[model samples]
Target chain A: MHTEAGPKRPTTPVQKGLQAIPLIINVISANFQLNQFSSLTLLEFALDSSVLLLVGGNRGRCVWATPMNNIIAYLFKSSLGKKYIMAVTGCCLFLFVIGHMVGNLQVFLGPEAINRYGHFLQSNPELIWPARIGLLVFVGLHFWSAMQITLENRAARPVAYANSKPVAASYASRTMVMGGLIVVSFIIYHLLHFTFQCKAINLTGQDFVGFTDPNNHHDIFKMIVVGFNQPLVAGFYLLSMGLLCLHLSHGLSSMFQSLGWKNDAYRPIIDCGAKVVATVIFIGYSSIPVAILVFKFGKEALK
Target chain B: MNLTLKVWRQKNGQTEGHFETYPARDIIEDMSFLEMLDVVNEGLISSGKDPIAFDSDCREGICGMCSLVINGIPHGGHAGTATCQLHMRRFKDGETITIEPWRAKAFPIIKDVATNRSAFDRIIQAGGFVSVNTGGTPDGNALPISKEVSDRAMDAAACIGCGACVAACKNASAMLFVAAKVSHLNLLPQGEPEKHRRALAMVTQMDKEGFGSCTVTGSCEAVCPKEIKLTFIAKLNRDFGVAALLGK
Candidate 1:
C-alpha cells in the first residue's frame, strides 16, 4: 500500500522537508530575478501548490484542510467569496479614483503649485511605484472577478426572458458592466495621453515628456494644457470621466451592502449618499476638461 | 374577460419546453391568476388534451406554492403579492399574457411551468435551524428578545419561499431567498450561538446548488411577495463575513 502511493507527493514529514528545500531555493531565486515577484505572491503560490499536492497525495483524494486553506477556498471558490473580493478591490479603486481626481484638480492651482505636486509625485519612486503596482493588482482582481461573476450569472439563466422589464433596479445598477468596459478603455487612452506622454495620441503635434518648467521640473501643467487643447482628446477624457462617475453612482453604496455595512435604517442615506458623491466626483473631474477646452484656463501659461 | 396566454409546455424535466398559446375566454375578473389557469386546464382536460402543470397550495397566498412568470414578471408584477393572490382584473381584457417557469439552473423544470425547488430545502438543511433537545415548552420570556429585534426578524420571516426573487433576478440569483432565511434565524437571541456557523454553512450550500451571485440590483426585493428588504442581504453579507473571519 505504501509503495503503491504516487512518488510525486512527499508522504512522510522527512520527505516533505526534503521537498521543501528545493521550493525554498526557487522562492529565493525567483525573488532575486523577477522584480515583480513579491514574496507574498510566491508564498501564496507555494501554499496553493502544497494544497494541490496534499489533495492529490494518492490516499483518499480528499481536499486538503487547514484554516488558511479554508479561507483561501472561501475567498476564491465560493460566490460570496468572489463578491467579497470584488467589494474590497472596488473600494480600493474607488479611493484611487478620488485621489486621482484630486491630483488632476491641482492643475487649477496654477503652474508652480501644480508642477510642484507633479514633481513631488514623480520624484518618489518608493511611494509611487508601489502605489502603481497595487492599483494594477486591484484593477486586475476587480475586473477578473467581475467577469467571472457575470459569466456565472449569465449561465445561471440559460433561457432568455421574452419580455422582461426593470422594476426597482436603477439604470446605473443595470449598466455597470458596460460602463466599466468603457471606463477601462478610457483608462488606457488617458494613461497613454498623460502618464506615458505619448504625443501621437495627444493630437497636439508636440512633445510633452521633456518640457521643463522654470524650476527645471517636468512641465506637467503645460503638458495638460496642450494635451487637452486637442478637441478629440479632451472629449474622450470628459466622456470617460462621465462613465466613471456613472459606474460609481451605484457602486459606492453597493460596496457597503456587499461588505455588510448597510442596513434598512441607513439604506436611504447610503443610496442618496452614493448618488451625491458620484455627482460631486463627476463635476470635479469634468471641470478639468471643460476648463481646458472651453474656458481655456491654462492656455496663457502654455505660451 | 378574454385573454390570450402563451404558456410554456413541457411533458417532463427531460423534454424540451415550448410556448403553446391558448385562449382563456370569459375569465371572471375576481378569479386569481392560478384560478384562471385552472379554468384553462379544465378546457384542455375536457377536450382530451394534456393540462398545463403548475404548483399551487393554500391559494390564500401564505403557503408560497403557486408560481408563474406572467408577462415576464414574476407573480404578475404586483407589489407584495404572490401568484395565488394575483387577481385576473389586474390584466386588461384581450391582453396577451406570457407564462414561464422559474428558469434557473438550480430550479429545473419538472413539468410545464413547474420547477424542482428542493435546492432550497437542501440549503435550509445545511444550516437554517437552531439545534435543541426535545423538552417541554420553554417560557415565552425565557430569552427576552427585544421588540425591535423580533419585529425585524418577523419581517425577514415573512418570505414564503415562492422563488419570485429568483425568477425576477436577471442573473437568476437566489441571494434574496438565502438572505431572508439567514436573517430570519440570525437576528434572534436563540440563534446567536450558531449564527456564524449557520451563515457559513448555508452560504456554502447555496453556492453548491449552482445559484448565481447577488449584484445588489434590487429586482429581487421588488418581486418578493413578502417585500423582504434588500437590507437582509446586506445583513447576510455582514454575518457571512463575520463568520468567515471567525472561521466557523
Candidate 2:
C-alpha cells in the first residue's frame, strides 16, 4: 500500500484478508481451468496481471474484462476454428430457409399443389425425417455460434459508462433474436396445427359454419382454410409470416457474407437477392391462408 | 430546430425501463450529436433535474465510447461514423427521435443509453489474439508487410470495437465483429506466427459468450460505422477452416 499522503493508504481488514490468501491458490485454480481449456488460458490471466501491475488502480477497470488485449497478438493463431463452424452453420440455415420457402410455394400452385406436396412428403416421411433432423442440427449450431459471438462482444467493454448515444442498427437486424423466438413459437404451433392435426386453433366446423361434412376424411388443406378464416388465427399467421420475412431478410444475405459471397459492386446485388428471396418466401407461405379464404370461404360463405 | 426526444431511461444496471419524452428546442443542426445531448443536459441541470447519462470521451470517434441506438439505428444510422463523430444535421426540423440503448440479449442496458458490452471483451479474451510474444515490440519497418496484407489488416483494424456490428446484426451475431478482430491481425505477416492458434482460441471464446450465430447477412457491415469490409469476415472463415482442417 502507498503511504505518502495526507490520508495514509491504510490496509483495511478486507484488503488484509484478501492479501493473506496464498498466490498458490490462485495459480492452482487457474491451472485447473487451464487443464480443461481448449487452448492456453494463461494469456488472459497473464494480461490481466500485467495490466494491473503496469497501470494499477486508475486504468484497472477500463481493461479488466478485455481478455482479448493479452491474446497472443495474432488472430490466425487464435480463432480460426470457430469462424469455420460459424460460416458452415450459417450457410446451412440459409439453405434451409430457401428450401422451406420452395416447399411452401406449393400452396400458391393451388390446393392440389399444397395437398399433393404434403401427401408426397408424408409418403416419404422416412426420407424427410432426416431433413428435419438436419434442420435441428443446423439451427442448434446457429444458436450456439450466436451465443458465442454475444459473449465475446460483452467482454470487449468492461467499464460501465455514464452517457451514450445510439449507433446504426436496423429494427429487423437488431431484433433478429426476438423475431427468431417469435418465429420459433409460430413454427411449433404451425406444426401442431397442420402436421399433427392438434385441433388447437378451432379447426372444427363450428368455427366457420359451412365447412363440415362429417363423412369427409379431415383434409389438411381444409384445416388450414378454417384456421386462417378466424380473425385471431389468421392474424397470428399473418404476423408470424411477417416475422419470418424479417428473419429471412437479414438472415439470407448475412449467410452469403459469412460464407464470403461478396463483390464491391455486386454486394448490393446480393443484398437485393436476399430481399427478393425474403419477399418471395413471405408471399409464397402467406398465400396459403389467403388462398383458402379466396377459394373455400368466399364473401358468400361467411353469410 | 425543435425536436421531441423519446429517450429510454433506466436507473441502473438492474431495472426495467421506459421511454421518457423531453423537448429539445432551438438546437443547432451542425453540432456533433453528443453536443446536442449536452445542450439538453445543461437544460436539465438548470431546471434541477438529474442530467441524462451517456458515455463518451474522445469526441473524435477513436475511443469508441459513444454507443447509441438512435431511432433503431446504432450510431444514428451513419455508415462508418461513431456516435461521437455524428453531426446533428442528419436530423430534420421537428423530428421526433427515439433514442435508446443497444438492444441485444448479450448487451444489457445499464442506465439511459449505456449497456454492458463486456461480452465483446470476453469473446476477444476467449481467443482473439495471436500467441507469439517474446517481449519485443518490433520496429514498424522490421517486418516486410506486403501492401495486400497491410491493406487487409487495415480493413480489419478499422473495427473500433463499437458494438454496432452486434447491434446491427439480426441474430445479435458477433461474427463480423469477432471475424474482423481475428482477420485484421491474422492477415499480416506479423500475424502469421500465431495464425492457427488465434483462430482456435477466439472461436471457442465466441461460443462461450452467448451470442447468436451468424446467418451471414451483411447487416453488420451495412450498419457498421467504420464500414469494415466483409472480406475480413471471409478471411476469418478461411483462417478458421485452415485451423480446423490443417492447423497443428
Candidate 3:
C-alpha cells in the first residue's frame, strides 16, 4: 500500500494484509507520516492499536507515543512486576500439581487402571513433553521471582530488629522459603525415583520392584506399592508432603492477593479455600503411600 | 512513672547511629509519649547535655509528623494511634522503652528519631493530582458521587503521609502509601480523565525511590494509624495493570 519505493517500506503479503485492517490503518495514519511507514513501524503500529482495542474505548490519542507494549513489557522488570510474574507462574504450577495428583490417584482404582493411565500419558510424547517443558518453565519463573523478591526484602531491612515480631502474617507465610526449599528437593528426588527410574542412588531400593505389564509398559502400581512398603521411603514422603502443604497453603492464597483477586467479602473464603486445597492435595498424594504401607491396599498389583 | 529511655542518636544521614540511654524520672502516666520526651529533653538541656531529637507536629496525631518505631514496632505498635498520641500509661513504671526513627533507604536519618520523608512528597508530585485548572468552586452536589464511592475515596484520602507503612513493611515497601493516593483520586469522577497517566507516573516514581516491592505481608495495614486497608494496594495493582496495558 506504500506509494514510496524505499527498501525499508512494507513489501510482504503480511504487511499488505495488515494494511487491509482498519484499526491498524487508523493507528498508522494517526501515529506516523505515510512516507515513514516501514515493516517495523507497521508492527509497532499494530501493537499500539491492539493495546487500545484491549483496554476498550479510546479516550484520545496517547500523549507519550512511546509504545505502551514496551512499557507494559517493562513492568515485569520492576520488583512489583516480578511479583506479578511470580503469582501468574505460581498459579500455573499450582494447577499442574493438582492435575498430577488427580492423575496419580487413579492408582486406587486398580493396577490396570493406573497402568493404562501411565500408558496414556507416555504414549503421547508430543503432548506430554510440551506440558513437561511448560511446567519446567513455570517452576523456573516461580523460583527465580521468589529468590529476587526474597533478596530484595532482605536488603530492605539491613539491620535486624532486636525484637521483631509478626503481627498479622501467619507461620506458613514466614516459613515459605524454607518450606519451598524442601518441596524443591522433594520434587527432584521424586522425579529421580519415578520418572527417570535411576537406581544407582536409590536409597530405598524400590527400583528393584520395577515390572513390565502385558503391554510392555512400566508397572507403576507395583513400583508405588514396593516403594512405599519401605518405612524410610514412606516416612520421607509423608514429611515432604507436610512441607508441600505449608508451601501451597501460603502460595495459593498469596497468589490470589498478588493477582488482585482479593476483596473484603471473599478474602476469608479464599484463604479457607487455599487451606482446603492444600490439605486435599496433601491427603491425596500421601494416601497412596499410606495405603500401600499401612493397609497393603496395592499388594495384589505388585509382582 | 520513672522509665529508662534508650533512644536512637544519629548525627546525620552520612554517619552511623546508635541508641543512648537516659533516665526519664518522675514521668506521669497522663503525659503523651512526645510530652514525656519533652520532659526528658528539658532535663538534658538543664544538665548541659544535648537534648534528644525527635519529630512531632499536631501532637493530637492528625498531622502524621510523629514518626517513631518504639520497641521494634512502628507507631509503638498501637492499634490506631500515632506516636504523638501514644501515652506513657501504655508502659509500666520503671519500664525500659527503646525508640528509633523510621528505618528505610528512602527515609534516611536526618538526626535522632527524624528521617527525611521528602521521598513521599516526590511521589505525590508525580501526577498524584487531577490536571484541572484553578477556577471557581463547583457545587458539591453537581458531581453526584454515590455515598459508597465518596466514602471509599475519603477513606483513602485519610492517609496522613506518615511513612509508618514503610517502616512497618518487611520490605520497606511504600505500596500502601502510593495506593492510598492513587485510589483516593482515581475513585472520584474528576480523576477519571487522568487515571491512566496518574497510575503510571506515580508507580514509576515509587519504584525509583528505592523502596522495596510489596509482598502484601499486611503489616502496613496493621500499623496504619488511620487504618488504611490493604485492599487499596490490590486496587492500585489492578489500576497499574490496566494502565500499563493501555499505555500512556
Q: TM-score, each model?
A: 0.89, 0.56, 0.86
Ranking by lDDT: 1, 3, 2
**Which stretch of 10 consecutive residues in model 2 chain A shows the poorest summed lDDT?**
A70-79
- Per-residue CA lDDT of candidate 1, range A1-303, in tens? 465544466567666666555445554455466453554455555774574444433443323322223566578767888889999999999999889889989989898988999989999999999999999999999998899899988988887777688778889889999999999998888889789988788788898988899999999889888888888888888888888888999999999999999987899999999999999999999898799889988888668
What is the TM-score of model 3 when looking only at chain B?
A: 0.97
Question: RMSD of each candidate?
Answer: 6.2, 13.6, 6.7
What tens-digit string does per-residue lDDT give for candidate 3 at B143-219?
78999999999999999999999998878889999999999999999898888888878887887788888876789
lDDT of candidate 1 at residue B225, scale 0 to 100: 88
Off by over 4 Å in 2: A1-117, A136-166, A206-227, A260-266, A295-303, B1-150, B157-181, B202-227
In model 3, which regions exceed 4 Å deviation? A1-72, A206-209, A300-303
lDDT of 1 by residue, B121-227 (tens): 99889985696657999877777888899999999999999899999998889999999899898898778889998889888888878888999999999989889
C-alpha lDDT of residue A260 in model 3? 74
- Per-residue lDDT of candidate 2, residues A23-109 (tens digit): 324543654754633334555555544544343323213334333333342231233333345557767776776687788765445
Error of 2 at B239 (Å): 2.4
How does chain A of candidate 3 score by TM-score against the true chain A? 0.76
The true-versus-predicted C-alpha distance at residue A67 of model 3, in Å, is 9.6
